[model samples]
Target: MEKSRVYFTDMRTTENSNLQKKLARLIRKAGIGNIDFEKKYVAIKIHFGEPGNLSYLRPNYAKTVADTVKDLDGKPFLTDCNTLYVGGRKNALDHIDTAYLNGFSPFSTGCHVIIADGLKGTDEVLVPVSGGKYVKEAKIGRAVMDADVFISLTHFKGHEITGFGGALKNIGMGCGSRAGKMEMHSAGKPYVIQEQCVGCRVCAKSCAHDAISFTDKKANINHSLCAGCGRCIGVCHRDAIKPADDESFDILNQKVAEYTKAVVDKRPCFHISLVVDVSPQCDCHSGNDAAIVPDVGMFASFDPVALDVACADAVNAQPPIQNSQLKEHWNESGDHFHKVGPNTNWKVGIAHAVELGIGTTEYELIRV
Candidate 1:
């Protein structure tokens, strides 16, 4: 197979060109303009950083991307689906509020922020995966599927579950609706955390299958009757419902690639990933650890798989920062992500994507 082109630009800034400007140049050079953006609704998928995580991509980078889209006559909106985990961004209202709090307001990014999933994280569009083994039908957020074009703006970092949360993780897991997220992460059933349950029956009211029952003021889920819609999780205010992360790490990676296919298939898609702050975990966390390695740079590509491989290789090439997490877990010859996160392997997802025809892992990194 022929190699895909992955463009790279270092973080160095001259007196005239800043990081944001460099980002704009990077994407443009990577061929973002090749897509037809005229009068189209473009979804720029992004993470608006959980309330206190300071390592997420800044609004300045988002603004540059949005402005570039506007320059091409496209209507761009900064968007992300609701997360499965309970946090500041669990619902649309809270998600937007958190985005604004994290400085992703319209005034800052030259675009509007839209929570792809509706208020309770139930609004979804059922998208079929053409060559899926793990996910036959993916439940993606409605607004994300509603967009005329798709673009992923990812903050590349070490992830406990996926080894590294790169383009695939950002698009697949990020685009999944509440139930979709449950399916990717687990077997699609949620069990109540008995200690946190007040037996208020708020979850019982939301269950479509009458699977939830209370005994001794603690709610329990009947897996036999449960349909796994995950609505009960959305309605629980006491943080009682916890979605199971039972899928093996490698299986989770493959499911993420399949869901990513559901999101980008039949749509004009592009991706950009920033390898900075190299956080030890996903930005979904309220807190973040120190950089595992020095910032590599920015990468952009039309092929999500190639983009991820290029970014991973760039990080591997950089020496680990002293006293960093990667430094602590340093293995002499293993891949950097595997050294940092022992259980998860990002290559599993990239390889699955290759089998699914997403893109080739073989890439040519062209420096910009």
Candidate 2:
């Protein structure tokens, strides 16, 4: 197999060219110029940081990408699906509000911010893929499916479950609607813990299928009626609702891979990952921890698997910050991320992505 090309640009900036200008030039040199961007609806998928997280990519970089798309005659929009957990981004209205607060507004990025899933998280398009482990079809956001092209502007960082969240993670789990996330993470059975139920009926109000009801001052979940959408779980104030544990960690990884494949199966896709911040956990948390390493820089590729592999390798090659979470496992050599996050096998996602014919793990880094 030919070595996939992964373009890289470090933190150094010339006096005339700022980071944003450098980003635009790097992307052009990375092969985005090959695509016919005229009049196409391009979905620039990204994680608009949860309200309190300060380590997310600034809106300036997004603006550069959006402006470049418009220059090529493509209509671009910054997009992301709602989260499954209760937070500022559980629905379109609140999610958009959070994005704006985090500086991802149309005024900031030169494009509209569309929550891919509609008003509630239920609005989605079911896309089919053969031989999937946990899902036969992925319930992706309608806007994301409607777009003519897909581009991911991802903040590459460590993830608690997947080891690292990169290009594939941004599109796969990030594109999934609330219910779709439930399907990917577990067996799709949500239950109410009686001990934590306060009989507030919040969960009942959020259930679209009338699957939740109150009996004896406690919430009861009717598994037959529940589509496993997980809205009820997020709405419950007492931490009552929970997803069942039928799938193991390994199964979860395979399921995520299948869903990811379903998302970009036949799409004209491009990916860019910012390997800065280098947080120890995902941005889904309300707050970001201290970075575990110095800012590495930016990477882009036509191949998502190769992009992620190169980003991980670049991060591991850096010296772990002395007082950060990476210090916990500095003695382990060769694979620093694995040693720091033993429970997560990020390689599994990349390897599975390759097996699904997404892209190859072997790559050649082209420094810009």
Candidate 3:
């Protein structure tokens, strides 16, 4: 396979070109101009940080991308799907509010914020992909599927499940609607923990298929009717709903890869990974720990797999931060993320993505 070109720019600034300008230049150098942007709906997928997480990508970077898209005559909007977990972004209302609070407003980024899924996180489009391990089809957010072009503006950071969250993680897990996320994270079986059920009927009301019902002063999930969308779990204030335990880590990784393919299958997609925070866990966590390593840099590519591989290599090259998670398990030349997340093999997602023909791991790092 030919080496994929992954463009990189360090945190260096000259009088004429600031970091933002450098970011734009890197994007162009990575081939953003290859796609026809005229009159197209470009979905700039990003994680608007959870309310208390301070390590998320800044809105300033998003504005740079949005402004560049506008210059090329494209209509750009910052987007992310509702999360399946109980949090501030479980529903569109709270999700939008969180984005606004995190400074992702139109005034800040020159782009509207759209929760990829609809109001309740049930608005989805099922996309079919053959030969997937767990999911033959991925239930993706409607807005994400409807977009004419896709761009992943990802905050490259460590993830407890995937080892590292980058372009693939952003599109696969990040773009999934609430139900889609459930399918990706676990097998399609959810149950109610009777002890945790408060009989509030929130889960019952939120379930689209009437799979949940209150009985004997507790909520029960009818697995037969439940599509395992995970909305019920998020709506339960008591944390009563839980997914089945049979879902293995490998299955989750494969499902994530399939879902990512569903997202970028037919689109002209560009990927940008900002490896700054280097957090020990995903940005989905309510709080970010101290960075495990010094900020590496920003990476961009048309190939997500190559981009992710390149970014991971860059992070591995940096010396571990003192007193951070990576330092605790420090092996001079070992994979720091894998040590932190022992149960997960982060390479599985990227490998599967390559096998699914999304992109390649072979890459040449081009310093901008």
Point to the candidate with the largest TM-score.
1
TM-scores of the candidates are: 0.96, 0.92, 0.94
The ten-residue window of minimal lDDT in model 2 covers: 231-240
| Cα displacement (Å) at residue 360, model 2 | 0.6
**Which pairs clash (backbone N, Cα, C closer than 3 Å) in model 3?**
none
TM-score, prediction 3: 0.94
Q: Summarize candidate 2's per-residue lDDT along 84-159 as a digit string, tens digits.
A: 7778898889899999999998998999999998877767888886667567888889899999988999999988
User: What's the lDDT for candidate 1?
Assistant: 0.92
- Name the runs in model 3 displaced over 4 angstroms: 195-211, 224-240
| Poorly placed runs, candidate 1 (over 4 Å) | 216-218
Highest-scoring model, lDDT: 1
Residue by residue across 126-182, what tens digits does model 1's lDDT show? 899999998889999999999999999999999999999999999999999888888
> Which consecutive 10 residues in model 1 have the weakest lDDT in total?
231-240
- Which lDDT values do the candidates have, in the order given? 0.92, 0.86, 0.88
The deviation in Å at residue 105 for candidate 1 is: 0.5
